[model samples]
Target: MALTYTLDNARSLIAVALIIFISWLLSENKKRFPFFLTIGAIAVQAGLVLLLFAIPNSQAVLSGVTAAVDGLADASDRGAQFVFGYLGGGQSPFATVPEGGQLPFIFGFRVLPLILVISGLSALLWHWNILKWITRLFGLLFEKTMGLGGASALAVAANIFMGMVESPIVIRAYLDRLSRSEIFLMMVVGLATVAGSTMVAYAVILGPVLPNAAGHVLVASIISAPAGILLARIMIPEERKATELDYEVTLKYENSMDAITRGVQDGVMVAVNVAAFIIVFVAFVGIVNNLLGLAPPLNGEPVTLQSLFGYVFAPVAYIIGIPWEEAHAGGNILGVKLFLTEFIAYIDLGNIPADAMSERTRMILTYAICGFANVASVGIMTGGMTVLMPERRSEILNLAWKALIPGFMATLMTAAIVAALPAQLFGG
Candidate 1:
């Protein structure tokens, strides 16, 4: 394929300007806007996208990571199969079926188990100081360029690999004294990116629709770190910079076994929460759609929850480079991501007919909703932060609600920047 740009790609550049302008308008102190800093943040995201997609060497590295993740997923499947037998993709015990016939892959049995394995593996890596060094490097970058304090920068960087609540633990000693801007930035980064362990499940969900799903998912989380910082600073510009610098990782495990054991325990809670959310939220949407169905049909189709969201977010989808004809469908997924979760949204994207939307459209949407920004996360972030800093509960609550705007827009900023590039660069 050849490198090319369409009208939509140029339009996405305009959308990037609009997104930044909108963030500026919402700034707590508009006069304090950091113009050059904003430019630097945008440049960082653009540079990363080009390096990962447009450069052959970087793309090769990304493919290697994707291949390793795929192997990890396969290993997780084998463990699940041993536990759940045929329900988990193991060979069927019955001989009545035709030779070489395959069994259905159960999400709970097959995909959910990857979280446990990845979570344990991530803990093991952290125990080995691998993740710590990588996080420290990114933290230094954020501290220098974004002007965030060492603790805040470290927490934000760790959010790429850790959960919203879990990342804050690394900076627990400074949580009580963290400036409002630092706290807000941590919340924004946490919500703007997904955990590394959960990335496996998301990549698996999107694998059929996107080539190298793991690579894209990984890139999305990594790049969004800077985007979140940029938006957070814009919305809540700090009057003074933080002085206390503590860059060391505070989270510790007694040993490798302890890390794996505790990590798996945490993963169980996450896996169960995901399973429950899917069931309850899908039912809620279904019930609401049925209620809407009794009222009237719109444009020769029954009015459903998704259609309502599609109508509301279609313009946003179009502004981000999805063609107008396909924007409504893309908007629907984006809406689902906002209200429900990215996990559900990715599943919906995968369920769409493969030919219904162009590959570029799918890739755009994939990058767009690849975050933890949603209604549910506001409460999660707030609750988690409150536990870490109970004395500042009121402050935490105030910032948590406000963090949602920048947090949500951060991922959209990433998608808009990606949309500005040639779709062929992403293998679309």
Candidate 2:
């Protein structure tokens, strides 16, 4: 049976409040007796969730977002086909294939071409200043509404345009001046967010396997942003005197050509890192599975690391509204996302036995696992921050562990919101 509205709202409210309380307890100012501050934070977080549901137009709002996401997917696909010609998975470039016959191509031949096309188009958009304008608008909204610093607000907003490290470059000049708490918030936000450029690729990869996959992924990221800020602030309250927030939109490049070139170069590096991380992490998981398989009853069986993760995380999956039958499978993907990257997790989700999971379970899991907050990303974030501000490298390193908790919490909060929504609203 579905949960009653009162029960659903109560559960969600308690979840948000608990997150704020936990954040305060874990932060450095335990001796400060920050009860009033904690209460206010919890109130704000709960109020946001309630506001989303309280509106009579809430369903329309979600539908509009879903439609916009689908439009972006359609446009991105068309752009991909134009840049890569037939290689981007359209009709044959030079020769036509027989009506029923399949094209002779390898994985890299098909997928890598799409990645290149998206990367190039992203560069072109940035060069035209389209992406910058969008970032600035979002930055202004976040800064004015959320009461965040200019640099942190801009970096978080730019996340929709670029990768974690790349977004930080938007406010590179202000990194050294940010307070320890603010720096921690920046890291948490970076970890919790996903880049827009990769959204196209992910949509293409999972669209075939899951309905509205692209739309859900976009919603997941957007919903996670506010939660990321709330959790990060709770973990480390703003301590230093507030500076005047600025909303300047500028791209650090010599020319349009240089911007495109640099953008593509950055994209290539991202793709390579993604590929390398997946290969190594999958192998490591295999090793662990092999050891686990050696147990007498499990020997020579198909038991894998995923199975273990499934068993370990199944309870939490159920708490997020996954059906009992599919919770274990959803749990496995969640585990992979946390330990490895979302790239591998999405691939695993696409291949998981359909009979083992319902469509609703799959959609919620996709939303839940759509962030850059994996264990591997921590090292990437730390190394990137070190280069950006050598003096604050120690501070970045110190806050790394705390940041991971809020980052993960942000994604979980998104999952909870989606889970609490009526399933029929998004075609679940």
Specify the highest-lDDT model's number: 1
Off by over 4 Å in 1: 94-99
Q: Model 2 lDDT vs. the true structure?
A: 0.69
Using TM-score, give the best candidate's number.
Answer: 1
| TM-score per candidate | 0.96, 0.82
Query: Which residue pairs show collisions in model 1?
Result: none
Question: How many backbone collisions does model 1 have?
Answer: 0
For candidate 1, the TM-score is 0.96
Candidate 2 error regions (>4 Å): 1-17, 30-99, 103-107, 243-249, 298-302, 353-355
Q: What RMSD does model 2 have? A: 4.3
- On residues 233-284, what C-alpha lDDT tens digit does candidate 2 reach at each position? 7667777764444545335666778777887787777777777787899899
